[model samples]
Target: MEDNIKDSKQLISEIQSQYTRLSKGQKLIAQYILNNYDKVAFMTACKLGETVGVSESTVVRFANTLGYSGYPKLQSALQELIKNKLTTVQRVEMSDDFSDENVILNKVLRSDMDNIRDTLDGIDNEAFQDAVSKILKAKKIHILGVRTSFVVAQYLGFYLGIILDNVHVVRMDMGDAFEQIVRVGEDDVVIAFSFPRYSKKAYQLVKYAKEKGASIISITDSLFAPIASVADNTLLVNNSMASFVDSLVPAMSVANALAVSVGMKEKDDIKDYFDDLERMWEKYGVYE
Candidate 1:
C-alpha cells in the first residue's frame, strides 16, 4: 500500500508516457484526467466516464493500464496529487454531489472517519516509536508547522510543554520562524507537521535543523513530501480532503498519541509535575 501510494508522485508522468498505447476510450479518459485533474480527483468512476464519453469499464481499464488495481485506486492517486495543487475555488467546484446539506454532512464525516482508519493502518510503528524515543532523550524539542498545519503543531507543543520543560513551538508571529529555532543543536529533536499545500518555510526550517545536527521527525501526508526526505523518521498520516479545507483529525490524533507516549515514559515525574500544576491552577481558579 505504501509503495502504491508513493507511486502517485510519478502517476502523471506514467500516464503521459503510455498515452499512445491507450485504446480510443482509454485515451479519452486519460485526456480528461490530464486536463481536469482537480475536478476529476473528486469524481466517481461513472461520472468520469460520462464526462469523457466512455463506458465506466473504459475508465477502469485506463486505471488498470496505469497499473492501479481499479478506478478507486486511480482516483486515490489523483486525489493525492491534487491535494497540494488545487486552489480553494477549484476544490469547492470539484464536488458535484453536495446538493443536500444532510448528504454533505454525512459525506464529510465519513471521509474523516476513513482518513483516520487509513492513517492507523498505514502509520509505521517503528518510526512512531523512534520519534517518541528521540523526544524523550532530546536536550530540547522544537515543534513546527505553518498555515493550516500550525494548529496541529500548537496542539502538540502545548501538551509536550507540559510533559517536558525544554519544548518550543516555533512562532512565526514573533519574527522569522528561522530565528525561533536558531538555537537548535545536536541534542535537540524537531517534530514538524506538514500537510498538503505544504509550507515551504517549514521545509526550510527542518532542513536547517538537520544541518545543525537535530533529529527531525516529519508527520506528513505522503512519503514523497519535501520534509520526508530530510526527516530522521517520517510518520505518514492521511489528511484526505472532503471539502476545500484539509482535515487535520488524523494528524491531531498522532500528536495526542506522541504526547501521551512521552508522558507515560516519564510517569513518575509527570505525575508530580501535573500535581503541582493542578494545585497552581486551582489556587488561581484557572478552570471552573
Candidate 2:
C-alpha cells in the first residue's frame, strides 16, 4: 500500500515540481488537476480547457509543458494515479459511453488493438532478452500471479513447464504463498505478474523473493508499479481500459512471446521430449 501510494503520488509530485514554471493558463489547468484529478482524468482536452476557462490549445500546451506528448498522455497518467482506487461500479460509470450496442463490440476490439500497438511501441527489448536469458539459466523458476494476472501466469507456466523441468507456478489456494518460495536463492528466478488494480500479495511475494536473493522479472503496466521496484528485469505492457473489465490481450501477448522465445531456444531438446510424450499419450489414448 505504501508503494501504491508512492506510485500515485509520483505524477502529482511531477506536476507540483513544475508548477512554478508554468504559464497562467497552464497553472489553471494544473490547479484543476490538483484539485479534481479524478474528474480531469476522464475529461477530453476541450472539456478540460472549458472547465479551466482556457482554450483547448492551452490544455494541449499544458500537457506538453509537463513533458507529455499530448493531453491524452497526461490524462493517462492521471488515470493511472486513480485506477487502482476506482471501484468496479465507478469503472462502469466512467465507461458509460459503451452503452450503445451498435458500436460497443467494435469499440472494445479496436481498443484492444490499440493496447497491443502501444505495448509493442513501448516495450523494452533489452529487458525482455535479459529475462529470457535469466530464465534459461536459473536453477529454479517461481512464477506468481493472483487475480486477473493469475490467468497469464498460468498460461506462461503451462508452456514453460513443458519446455523446462524447473518451472513452479506458486499456488495461492491454501497455505501461505510466501512459504512456497522461502528457499529461493541466487540461482533461482521469480517472475511476477501485476497490473492495475495491482495485487498487494504479488508485490510482497516478489519483494520477498528479491530479499531472499532470487532474480526478479516483473511484467506490469507501469514502471511505477510496486513489483517494478523489486524486479531485476521489468516488462511493460498496455491494458485496455475502455470498459470495467480491463482487456488482458497485451499482457497475454507478452506472455505468449516469452513462452515462444523460450521454446525456440530449447527446440531441439523440446522436440525429443514432446515426441516421447506424444508416443506415451498415443499409447494410452490420452487425446481420444
Candidate 3:
C-alpha cells in the first residue's frame, strides 16, 4: 500500500506488483495492457474499455486500481515505457497489427493526424519561446542528432543558420564528432534531437554538453527521454508509432514550427542575408 504510484518503475512491474489487489474486470484490463501495451498506449479510455469488453467507467477505475490519478496518467506511463524501450521486433509486430488488419490507408493517416494534433496541443509555448531565446543569445549553438533524428537536426540547423550567426549541425560522420563540440562552454547551447528507441550515443553527447556547462534544449517525444532528463528546455512533439516505420510527421512539423518562430525573431537579419545571397546567385548565373 505504501509507495503505491511510482511511475518510474516499469508499467509491467507496477501492474504485477498490484496484481493481487485487482478485481476480475480490473485484472482483465491489466492483462490487456501488459500484453499489448504498445497498442493500448494510443487508445482512449472508452476505446480501451471496448477492447477489453468492459465499460468506460471500469477502465477509469482500473487506472485508479493501478494507482494512477486517471486513465491519461496511466496511458502516459505506458507511452513513456515503450518510447525508449521498444525492441525492433516489438516495433515491427505492432506495425503489422495495422497492415495485417487491411485498413492500412485510413488507420495510418488518421493516426498521423492524431499525433500532429496532440503534439501541437501538448506543446508548452513558454518552453518554445525559451528555446528560441537561447538560440538567439548563445555564442554558438550545436545541434546534435543521429540515425533517423539526424535529418531533423539538419533541417533545423540549415534554416536556423540562414537567420542566426552561428549554428553548427553535429554529425556522427565527422568520426570524431565529440571533438567538434569540445569547445562547448557556458555561453553555448546544444539542441539535441531524440525520439523513440532513442540513441544512447546522442543522450551521452547531450550529457557531455551538460557537463561542459552548455545549456541544453531537448527536442524529443517524451519528458522521460534521456535528453529531456538533463535539458534546460524540452520541446515535446508526439510521435505515436502507428507502424513499423516511426512516424516523423510530428517531428518534422515541430522542426518547421521552431524554424518559423526563430525566423520571425530574426526577420530583418534573415531578409538582409537573403538579399546578399540573391545578388551572389545572380552574379554566378546559378539559376536555370
Candidate maximizing TM-score: 1
Q: Give the TM-score of candidate 3.
A: 0.83
> lDDT tens string, model 1, 1-288?
233776678888988999999998988888888898877888999999999898888888888888888888888888888788877887778665876787998998898899999999999999999999999999999999998899999999999998899999998788888888889999999999998887799999999999999999999999888999999999999988888778899999999999999999988988899899899999999999
Q: What number of clashing residue pairs does each candidate have, in the order they appear?
A: 0, 0, 0
* Regions of candidate 2 where Cα sits further than 4 Å from its true position: 1-32, 46-55, 65-67
Q: lDDT for each of the candidates? A: 0.90, 0.88, 0.85
Per-model TM-score, in order, reads: 0.93, 0.86, 0.83
Task: Evaluate candidate 1 by giving its C-alpha RMSD to the native, one decimal.
Answer: 1.9
lDDT of 3 by residue, 1-288 (tens): 222223735668878888888888888898898899877876889988998999999999988877778888887777766667778786776564565566888888897999899888889899999998998889999998989899889989898888887989997887787898989998999999998788989988999999999999999987778899999999998887776677788888988888899899889988899999999999999996
Output the lDDT of residue 200, model 3.
Answer: 87
Better of 1 and 3 by TM-score: 1
**Candidate numbers sorted by lDDT from highest down:** 1, 2, 3
Candidate achieving higher lDDT, 1 or 3: 1
Any residue pairs clashing in model 3, and if so which?
none
Worst 10 residues of 3 by lDDT: 1-10
In model 2, how many backbone clashes occur? Answer: 0
TM-score of model 1 vs. true structure: 0.93
